[model samples]
Target: MVDLASLPPQLRRAVDDEMRRLRAGDGVLYGDMTSEEAHDLESADGRALPPDGALDRFIAHATVPPADVAASDLAGYTLVGVVPEGPGLDGPWSSVKRVYRRPDGVLVMLHEWAYVAEGGGVLGVRELMNASVRHGTARCPAQFAIRRAPTGQTVSELRWFTDAKVFTLSVAQDVLADGGKDHGKAWMLRLAEAIE
Candidate 1:
């Protein structure tokens, strides 16, 4: 269950709308669907990653188990899906992802993977910032701001690197809302706890 009262007013209304859609049987709840299907929805735009080889690649490259998001970590959320990337035998080319959804349509994705430093050796600041979270350790960290979207909506993003891996958790910021600042903060902390 989502902490509805804590959500910003507009978000609360949006969540309520989603619930009504669910009760009307318009769409399926993530908890009721297969993991693979969920992964497909989330990763439709990324490199295809099936379950079998994905885990092994992540374990080899990342300092922590990036694919280990569990029910306990997402108590009130649904384990909507997972996807993996670049699981080739060479260079541990792979990443693991887990996506969670609140009862409403709000979504948060937990993604982890090793960075592929271009030009070999050490990665350049700009390259690191673009490819992974811009934690202080990165050659160049990402620059985030409360920029306005085309729709005139404010977007908020926070990224960081930890234990040699990148972790990014974002919310679709809405100008009408508080930009989900608290929500993003809490989820990032949860993801950080999973770091080894």
Candidate 2:
């Protein structure tokens, strides 16, 4: 077994933090068992282990599912929410959105803004217009795709980029697929009203 103590300080710290988080019920730890091992275990007693028992053991090992799985598989535990506008690199007020794998799963966040003209000049207008033409349509300017550990289903969210300001939105898989679509469309319409 790899000696945790022999790892670099940063790696050790990260491992420690991850262990703590997992123990706190914020996440699950699963072991990396090969297909052969799984088959052997399943065939050992001529009967399969209960589903919950298998899940519990897998969680204990801290196993991460393969990356190829789509996020849609873990929809039951996925969540989404909007982050409030806040200060930014240039100044105050920016919008951001966050997606959670499980209620406590790692959060994936996205930020976006409209392309604005810098000055009342033809060049500036042309540049801004070009950007708007490419990214400012009914389609969401910002989006997120997530695949939860252990189960590789994919969940996604799409949102309007709107103005150069910030806003946050959060939701779960069903909401993201259904309600979020409407919400994003509405946001796009509102943005068009403001700009056009």
The numbered model that scores best in TM-score is 1
Query: Per-residue lDDT of 40-121 in model 2, one digit per residue for the tens?
Result: 3223223323334443342333212111113232334343432322233322322222233445453322333322322111
lDDT of 1 by residue, 1-196 (tens): 1255666798777766644432221111111223553444344324434435555555676433453444334556655555555545443444566556656656555565555432122222221132233233333243222224333333334445543555544434431245435454344444445434
lDDT of 2: 0.31
User: What is the C-alpha RMSD, rounded to one decimal, of candidate 2?
Assistant: 20.8
Task: Tell me the deviation in Å of residue 132 in model 2.
Answer: 13
Q: How far is candidate 1 from the true structure (C-alpha RMSD, Å)?
A: 14.9
Check candidate 1 and list the clashing pairs: 86-93
Task: Point out where model 1 deviates above 4 Å.
Answer: 1-64, 67-75, 87-93, 116-155, 179-196
Q: What is the Cα-based lDDT of residue 65 in candidate 1?
A: 48
* lDDT score at residue 169, model 2, on the 0-100 scale: 28
Q: State, as a TM-score between 0 and 1, how close model 2 is to the true structure.
A: 0.22
